[model samples]
Target: MKKKELIMIGLMIFSLFFGAGNLIFPPIIGKEAGTNMPITMIFFAVTAIIFPVLGIIAVAKSNGLKNLAGRVDSVFAIVFTVATYLAIGPALAMPRAGTVPFEIAIAPYLPEGSSVKTALFIYTTIFFGVVYWLSLNPNKLLDRISKITSPVFLILIFMLFLGTFIKPMGNYAQPSEIYSKNLGLQGFLDGYLTLDALAALNYGLVVVFVIKSKNIIEEGKITKTVITTGIFAGMMLFIVYMMLAHVGASSASMFPHTKNGAEILANTVRYSYGDFGGILLASIFTIACLNIGVGLTTSLSQYFNLLIKKVPYKIWATIWVIWSYILANMGLNKIMEYSVPVLLAIYPASLVLIMLALLDKWIKGNTIIYKAAVYPTVAVSIISTLDKIGISVPLLTVLAKKLPLHNADLGWISVTVVSFIVSFCIVHFSEENK
Candidate 1:
């Protein structure tokens, strides 16, 4: 591909990764981080950008998530890959994307006594209709998304960032309680919660296929293209995150007690642009969410088609769009509330899998090592997630909480590391015996 095409592909990746949570996270982080914004954003980029970039590279290197997880075992490959797809697809992220714009941008303006559910139904029907159409033609994603939708989305975001500087909100407040101490770790943990890492593993196939369609057929060239595009996407995310975080920090004093990023943004935009600001913010959300909807639908459909060859891609797209549409209308907030525990359980395993994939060469791609690292990570995370949701295995939950970094929701990291070391040593001693 030419330089311009590469840039456009990068923008497509950006649009795919940039969604409702992406919009919501930075502002709250900025509100709390305040004076610590610089250090905080750097660490935030570690999980948010670096890990996700690595995930794309890892998946691309392994051909796909299933192949990467297959280093553990075939059963694990199928199970983990499917779970990751569903969690990031229609089950959670896709539905949330379909409804968030309606909640934040459209719902507030509904006529008094209007039926919110009815309005959501009409809006989502239109939303998913567009998503399904675009997703059915994944080959044209480059033209539709990278060339058109993504550029428009970027312009609107730039408008919001420019407004913040043209008319400043207020000075950043002192760091909030949670952010005052362990700022870097807090930033990493918060960024980790974005779920972009898992999305990267799934979206890597999308990026790879898009590049291959351009007739870049060599594996080495494909890997390099994907990595370059991944890094470019990460850079865009960093720039956008800084802009949003600045908006959040500058508005801290102005919008005191604002509970979430959506509220902060709505208040900031309205203050800066008045009634028209609502329209602008709404436009931003609609485009952002729509971009995500199409991206997820396309990627998920493509994967399902690959997994089950008898089913065509268009049929898979139709299935996901309908499923997501049904789920999107069943109360957006309820979907979000129920999704938390499931995502928490899967996230650590995703991270560990990515790490192992990246280190595959050095580790000699040992299945024992992969099993040691991944199994404990999932076990610890699931126990912890269950405990949080009040469904604890009493003994395991207690032991999990006592592990290092448990309070930070990262107890699994320590457990995975210990498991990996023991397994590596066992492999080495067996080799010595041989």
Candidate 2:
């Protein structure tokens, strides 16, 4: 590809990675982090920026999403890829695509006694139905709409940030309960829960599909091009995330103490631009969310169309919209809570695959080593996730409860350590056997 074409591709990839959830988290972290916004932003950037960039690079380096996970094992490749896509699509991304519109746009307008349940049901159905319809035929409209929305989203956010800078909110209050100590770490972890990095992994597949369809790079060179493009895309993501976090921190005093991240973001936008600002922000979020839904649905439909052979694209898209609409009606807060354990179960396994894929040249696609690394990793991740949701794993729970960390999310830390140890042992034993 020409240099100019590559740059445009990189920008498009970057825009694809940024979504409505990405817009919501920073401000929530900022509000709670209060006096420690800087620390929090740094920590948040680790998962929000660095991990996601690494995921994209992993996909690129491995030549495609299938190759990235397939290196682990054929069964694992299928299971992991399918699970991740579903988690990011119907279970998380699609429903969220609908929810953000309501939380940011519709929620504030409702009367005290009015039925939020009814409104959510209607809005989500229409929002995802439109997504289903548009995604059924993937074309230039997808790109054009996203191109328009991404900039508008960025501009609305910039205006909100400008308001915060020009006329600051009240002085930062003391850090909230969790953020009071080690504000940076707490804020960073909180930001990680926004799951943008996970989204990037799924979105990178779409970017790769686009690149291939355009025939911009030869088959052999796709891997190198994807990595290079991903770096540029990742840098853009980092810049956008940092800016949003800063904006959120700056506007902390303007919002009430709300537990919901979406609520905090909506309130901040309303404070910055008043009713007009609210409408503008809502429009931006709605467009951004819709694009995300379409992209996710299209990606999944394509994958299944390939995998199942008999499933038509339109059939898969329709099924996704109906299922996602049902999931969306459960409400955002509940959906998020339900997703945590699933994320915990999947994230470590995904991370391990990403790490191994990036280092594949060194590892030489060793199946024994991959199995050794993955099995224990999955076992520990399952235990850790169960621990997180207050479900006891008996032996694992007993051991985890004694750990010296907040709520034992440190379980992930343990899982990583154990995965390495197991992989090393397997490699050593296998070499001796050979």
Candidate 3:
């Protein structure tokens, strides 16, 4: 691909990853982290940017997520792949894409007597309608998102930043209770809420499809291009997070008691630009969510159509859009309440799988090594998620917190590393015995 094409593809990928949760999490961290924002953002970038970029690279190098996870076992490959698509697709992220714009940019401005539920239904119907139409023709996505929509989205965000610079809301206040301790860990955990890493696994193939559409067929060239595009996209995400965090921090005193980043963001723009701020924010979110909705709807339909040949791509697309529409009406907070625990559960396993794929040469495609590394990580992840959601597994939850990084909600890392080591030793020992 040419340099210009590479840049556009990077922008497109960035838009795909920057959806509902992406817009909301950063500012809340900035607001809560206050003086700790700098350190907090660095850790946030690890999961939000670095891991996501690595996921794309890993999937590209391995051809696809299913192929990468299949190295563990066929059953795991099927299960994980399906779970990931759903988690980032119709199950959570897709519904979020539909609802967030309405919540942050539209709902607040709704006429007092208007039914919020009815407004949401009308808005989402139109939202997903545009999404479905654009998704039907994935070939135009690069032009639609990167060339047209994403640039406009960036401009609106810059306007918010300009407003902040022109008239600062308030100074970054003291750290909140949650951000008072383990600020770095808190930031990292917050980044998980974006769910971009899972999107990375799914979006990598979408990028590949775009590249092949341009007739770039060489495997080596495709891998190199995809990795390059991922890096560029990661850099963009980092920059935007920095801007959003600053905006959040500045809004600290003005919107101190806000619940989530959505509230902070809406308040920031409104405070900065008066009545016009609502329009600006609404445009920004609608563009951002629309980009994501199209990318995801297209990608999910493509993947599922390939997986289940009986269901045509259009049917799958319609099914997801309808499902997302139904779930989106349940309201954003409720959707997030149910989705966060599931995201927490699967995110660790996704990270582990990405790391293992990147280290594939060392493991030499050993299924034993794959199982050893992934299974324990997944087990610990499930227990940790259960504990987080207030479900105490008998003996397991207590054992999980004892592991390193549990306080940071990263207890699975140690388990995964230990399992990898034991599996490595067993593989080598058995080979030597033979």
Best candidate per TM-score, number? 1
**Candidate 3: clashing pairs of residues:** none
Error of 3 at 415 (Å): 0.8
Full ranking by TM-score: 1, 3, 2
- Give lDDT per model, in order: 0.90, 0.72, 0.88
Task: Estimate the TM-score of every prediction.
Answer: 0.97, 0.87, 0.95
lDDT of 2 by residue, 214-301 (tens): 6756755776677777777777766776666666666566665666567666666677677776677777678778778877887788
- What is the C-alpha local distance difference test score of candidate 3? 0.88
**Candidate 3 lDDT by residue in tens digits, 1-434:** 78999999999989998887788888888988998898999999998999889888888888888899999999999999998898878887888888889877999899899998899999999999999988888788888888999889889888988888898788998888778888877888888767788888998788888888889889999989888888899899999999999999989887778988888888888888999999999999999899889988988988898889999988998998888988888766777788778878888889988999889888888999999999998899999898878899999999998998898788998889989999999999999999
* Residue-level lDDT for 208 in candidate 3: 86
Which parts of model 1 have CA positions greater than 4 angstroms off? none
Per residue, candidate 1 scores C-alpha lDDT tens digits across 66-178 of: 88989999998899889889988998888988888889988998889999989989999999999988888999998999888898989999999888888888899899877
Clashing pairs for model 2 are none
Question: TM-score of the candidate numbered 1?
Answer: 0.97
